[model samples]
Target chain A: MNVVGRRTLTVIALVALAIVGALTAEWWLSQSPDRPFGHTQAGHVLGWAGLLLMLLVLAYPFRKRHTPGQRWSKSLFQVHIVGGLVGHLLILLHAGAHLHALIPVLAMLAMGLVVVSGIVGQVLHALAFRTMNEQRRLLLHQGLPEPEVEARLQALAKQEETFRLWQVIHGPLTVTFVALAMLHIGGALYYGGF
Target chain B: MTWPPPFSMYPVLLTATLVLIIGLGWASARDPESFWAPGDLSVHHAGRMSCTQCHEPFRGATTANCIACHADATFISQPDSPPQIFHRQAARERARCLTCHTEHRGTTARITTDPLNPHSEFIFRVTGTQSCRDCHAGVQKPGPKYGLLNNDAVRRLVAKGKGAHGPGRFADCFRCHAGGRTGAERGS
Candidate 1:
């Protein structure tokens, strides 16, 4: 078999393991002859992965070692944003969309806020990327902060002048998102499972 | 056919539940489409595994995985440590992974930590605060042993209170706490 066929079989095996894991979880749930213990393990797999995945995605880019002026920055950030958004979707599913529990609710809210902030930061980051590119394209002074100057040097694309602003704004928003994410997890610890 | 209660059925029940769950999960895995969006890439990433990786598995399809991750955390019980502990066993009677997690339901469940125990307070007051009473009573021995707390006020402080300067606000602290920073309701 070719590489593709080999990879396909591996994927199939993983699926099989996942099914076994699920069934194992179900059995664990059923073990509580009197208390419904086994009954619950049946449903916890995805939520765990979702919460962790979102945090991992959010932290990956800035956590990576990269030069500020590198070309890969834009692509890296786009990946970060997409990963974060997808992770959040998984987390919501993991929680079963229930936040009635005070601690869990607060945690979920904090997580939600972090994701929203991440979204805003992604937009700002994109804007910054565009601005930096324009600054590069026009051969303007990297130190120069004026859009008009950048415009005059080039064809004066409206997009050119606004890039620096995005760069400046994204920094603070990303920091806030990180801080909120910590609080969300910490608060979840405080409230606990009943 | 042992009764599934207390300690007797622990092993059998656990095993049986495991088998049943394996079967159900196996059946669910046969289909790739049930796990995600039409052609979701993550499903492929998961190798077609069901959504139980991070979640807690219960009887059928519950998903409360929070407790599994946060069980050992002190935040689940009390904010501050008490002078006495009632539940001295330390997670002895706490809920199982599934009881607290119960998954696939929703993220909004009312997550709550167990409260601190009350008996520890009762035990602490009786032993610690009264430690000096033995020597300070002056009638027992000569008093000069290791010298930890003020043995002089032996008879008075226990009856009244003992603070840095002198005397405490709450009169019957030992009546509640039980012992010195140790008792039944330790982490409540």
Candidate 2:
């Protein structure tokens, strides 16, 4: 498929996931009493599932470093991205609309920032290819030899490396989110909640 | 062209994250009593600054702590006195007060955590074509004062009527059959 079509599909999928999260939250709030979200069975399920998915997302870096026999790195990377998104969705549900407590709110904020930064990084990487292709075609038309054209493309690629700065934001935010999640879970246990 | 991180940013990010986590842990440990509270307590319990008021140090809140304040005569003297009679019944059955009266819910949270059928408060089990409203009409009478039609106030009214109706009359039927079932000797 074309680059624009692929980007559109990604956007649509993200939007769909967001809608699902919204509807689920609305239904949960409407159907249940205004109790603490973390205390309910549904909240517990969401919390555990989100935690599991987040741990699975951490596996991506390791998987990318290896050939891993039959499984492909590209597929694993896609799973990582999607798993992080859905995991954050579950965490949002676990928090519910009433973010009354300070610690939990901070944790949720960190998680949200991490997910947003990761999405921006993904978009930049996907769209960078189209920009590179256009530049390469233009250089070739200008009668540059194949080797010179390749060299110019390398320079352009180097310029686009600015997007890698997203990792600085994404990585720290991920750590903060994980730390806060641990705190939240521990606090829950200490307070005699599951 | 500046190539983003240039391989030096990773260390900086890692260090910052480590510092933040350490700071958070330090802050948390500074107060051994600190933990994420579930939510706000009820208005009457607003003065309770610590979990120890309701919860035990580590073993968690017991029914004994609940009975300490709740079973006080002054507290029970209040109009909305929390059905301590029912609580006594629950205690006899070894039921925890927390089962029904969950705290930290919210300011206006109705303390009944579980569905408490009012009929459960009766001495005799309400069965066989009986509904709660049949005996307890005006139970939720909404004005300022307790309406004279239902509840213990009505029980008092029945006791007075028994004396006026000249002893051993039908006050017992007044419980189930209501005021209409009683005839002219009914206390005005």
Candidate 3:
């Protein structure tokens, strides 16, 4: 067996398994009963862990830049996509499909915004990735040097279909996520605060 | 062989125990995990040393008695239960503080606190929130035509329209319509 290939697969597997673990914890703990301070706190912790994982998925480019030492990383994109989707699933389990009507409705709006943007981001990101892949294939056919190919991929990453639209949506998306997050926190404070 | 009750009675016994559990929780004033969370309405003041201790009956719950407990003269005991908040409510309708201030009943305060509880009995007719969609169905979206979308969120959204952008009136219909005096304060 190719140890390096196996290790790459192992990393992806671990990330996916962690997502499932978070989801399981979320489900188990939400059913445990909600209290000001109780076992359900574990569920809150897991939910946030899932969100952090999703954010890592969002920050795919930064990771690639920083980790130049590991070139044969074997497609972190797949891991990123799978990890982000798993977080969404786990988040659902954490909330336990029950919430006060007002705050939950507002929360649903924020989540829906995230889901829509994520879908758009995924499609554009996929399309751009595919195009880049095709360009690399064509260059190989034309006998382009490895350096030239690497330069091309870097250039494309800077500006492409998904990244271009992302430039517009990325900031608003951040603002909305952060703003709605503050509102979510405010609601928690209002409900559970002194 | 029989140390206790029969097995056949288990279902009935379980139901009885559950009802007892809820009753105890209710009496004790705490949240319940017994699947009936909302049904758990602990009395706000059942252990009150006396209604008269806190509630000063006026020339039969006169406004003075309201001010007595509701004002700063007495360090307001329960922040949630304030009179001036409802004083203007009582004053505008020429209503006695005792009207909504019925003290003996358990969880009577729920009329104000519980959003689903109806306000039909009160002179303050409208549910502090909305009353229409109580049953009429599907009036909420494509955005409440005559103005049901005026809930707090919508109102804040509309406030945004008003503050930064010029007026359009459609941003938050819920603030005005759901609020008391349909077209008065929030209709702006």
Which tens-of-lDDT digit does each residue in A1-194 have in candidate 1? 85445654574475446445644544454443222221133334555555566556655455443443444555656567666655655545444333333334444566556655554454455555466576565655546556666555456443453444543444444444444445444433332222
lDDT (Cα atoms) of all candidates against the true structure: 0.42, 0.63, 0.48
lDDT per residue as tens, model 2, B30-119:
643333666667655765646666666445567787778766454445444225445545656778777766666666444454533322
Candidate 1 lDDT, B93-150, residue by residue in tens: 5535433322232222112112222222232344454322332232222222323244
DockQ: which is higher, 1 or 2?
Answer: 2
How close is every model to the real structure, measured as TM-score? 0.31, 0.63, 0.37
How would you encode candidate 3's per-residue C-alpha lDDT over A14-68 as one tens digit per residue? Answer: 6557556754655565442122111145556656775677677755545665785
> Which one wins on TM-score?
2
Better of 2 and 3 by DockQ: 2
Docking band of candidate 1: incorrect
Lowest summed-lDDT stretch of 10 residues in model 2 chain B?
B118-127
* Best-matching candidate per DockQ: 2
Q: By the lDDT metric, which is better: model 1 or model 3?
A: 3
